[model samples]
Target: MVDVLEAGGWGLLAGSALLLGAVLGYTLRIPHQVVASVMAFGAGVLLSAVSFELALEAYDRSGMLPLVLGTVAGAAAYTAGNVLLARRGARHRKRSGQVRGRSQPSEGQQAGSGLALALGALLDGVPESAVIGLGTAEGGAVSAVTVAAVFISNVPEGLSSSAGMRGAGRGKGYVFGLWGSIAAASMVAAAVGSAVAGALPASAVAAVTAVAAGAILTMVADTMIPEAFEEAHQAVGLIVVAGFLVSFALSRA
Candidate 1:
């Protein structure tokens, strides 16, 4: 149907942001301050997206029960999985430059580390991509704030992850291919989310929205905020504020 195609189009538009970030990460030597600034800004934008878009939307439609359960489950799931990966020496996922962890993993550990990073990246993209679907479901439109938050944050994440993968000795071909695949998968999830979103009941909507909200909040708190602060220190707070302002302005516009 036309709606499906439209949803697919929106999904591709949003997913392309991550691909752009990946390309930047692989090809350029972006400065750490620049990376930190983008991360902080992205975090702020995501905070707003969570508050106004996800939480408020769920509360308005389905009340608090689904919201609570969904949020808690999402946060818990992401935290547990991320912690497990971190323990496996893949914790430097948000590094601005090279991973500060083990530079020379045994040949065996290299693939493991790469896989962990890839999984982590996938987890990061899911909620954001789902958000694109939420917008399309409502009106076949996408939220600019959601797109901005996901896109901006992915720049630093891609930079760091790509750098870490290379440091782990992953080939360039493999690196691009991995990111390209993830981008494609995210686009598909968004498109499917759009196509099916209208069919879901209120409770299902609440669960899905709240779950995405919870996972994003946890991921930002765990990974993005800390990395932003680490890279930019006191300035990171201001950058976050600026990001919020910019996103707000865009939303209003």
Candidate 2:
């Protein structure tokens, strides 16, 4: 089971990397509104998967108390880190406000947007990968399915990164860097998840899973939902429901 899970996990991780590359290499050409809708749907599927599969499994394996504590701890830690990053970004944006308004950037500022994009991808990459890795480590039954689910969830992320680059008027090479950063982070997360899985208690894993789910849920509601709505598309709710059904169906089968 471990061997099967590991193999499936690696495949999923690689698939995620490929999906990201495809987005950078090709999918960015799609319209922004369409992209936003797909992203929202993906987010809904992923958030639901994490809650129903990973967190719930952890709780069943461990206990409710551990799950609750771990979720809180995970949320608190991520929240703190996010807050810090936001503050730093705000400060930097303030200092660079004059430059942003300009038509062109100085040499030092030229790569700033790409750099920021890479940094954001780096922050998100590890955790996303870890979640996938954990899903696989839990067993063969969920391994391949988890990977596919995450791959779909990540489509929007890759799109968002690419869109940011395009909007910033950055080159294709710079956009590709964002995907590369995410792939690299996924690799790191897979390594970490595999290594730690053997030593961690079920409770610890459950807690982390809960925390991850919460963050992902927040992202879906705050970012993806808003983006999906801005496109004047009324089909978003249906798409979201469809995405959830797809994720659930895949997991069950």
Candidate 3:
């Protein structure tokens, strides 16, 4: 119970950033370039965390087979889901509705886009939070690198997605409610991940961690990097490298 609570606490702490970003997006007039830079930085953070913290740890725990299979499976799953969501009008979920060069969806598309956006957020967030629980299942301290990466990355995701929802004519109620629910779900995912991992064998735990790493890697490539490059362009590369170095330092520390 203590472990579960601890994991949930950490999960909530990270997930809270989404709500913060949502509020900022709705209330502020932040520039696209700034959002893009931050998004790129966050993506780099996540990349480093996935490589050194999650995937490396998983490799050290079990052998190559579990790590490779799990990663491939995770990436495949996320790709399939993303394709479905895209077909349903959530392809620009990470955009500000105007940043991607695509026109705003018509009224008919707006009605269903909100639901797709909510689901897309869930698909992106749940696996990341689950790994937090995996980190604590051994009764050790949760990985600070993973927690920080998730929190930092989620801020831009929430901000950009909320901005897109707003531009799509979504109401404040729907936008906030969607993020709030997803945050709550993140807490639950972390707790459940901890509980489940505690009962699994070491190989299984490693596979699960690898799975999360793969999903996160795919997400960063598919959604985040493109959006960042859309606005920040050449500067995003430097910002990403800086973010990666910071996360790598945290992992070492």
Local distance difference test, each candidate: 0.75, 0.58, 0.83
lDDT of 1 by residue, 1-253 (tens): 5666666666666666656766776677777778788889988888887887788887887999999998898899889988888877675444333444535445445445556766776886776686677677886567877777777766666666666566566788888888878788777777788878888898888888888889888988987888788769979999888888877777778
Candidate 3 lDDT by residue in tens digits, 86-186: 78876544443454567756654553555665676687678878889888877578999999999999887778667666767789998898899899989
Best by lDDT: 3
TM-score against truth, every candidate: 0.89, 0.75, 0.92
Name the weakest run of 10 consecutive residues (lDDT summed) in model 3.
Answer: 91-100
Model 1 lowest lDDT segment of ten: 93-102
What CA RMSD would you report for each candidate?
A: 2.7, 5.3, 2.1
lDDT of candidate model 2 versus the reference:
0.58
Q: TM-score winner among the candidates?
A: 3
Q: How are the candidates ranked when ordered by TM-score, highest leading?
A: 3, 1, 2
Q: Which stretches of candidate 2 lie over 4 Å from their true place?
A: 1-28, 77-118, 138-142
List the candidates ranked by lDDT, beginning with the highest: 3, 1, 2
Clash counts per candidate, in order, are 0, 1, 0
The better candidate by lDDT, 1 or 2, is 1
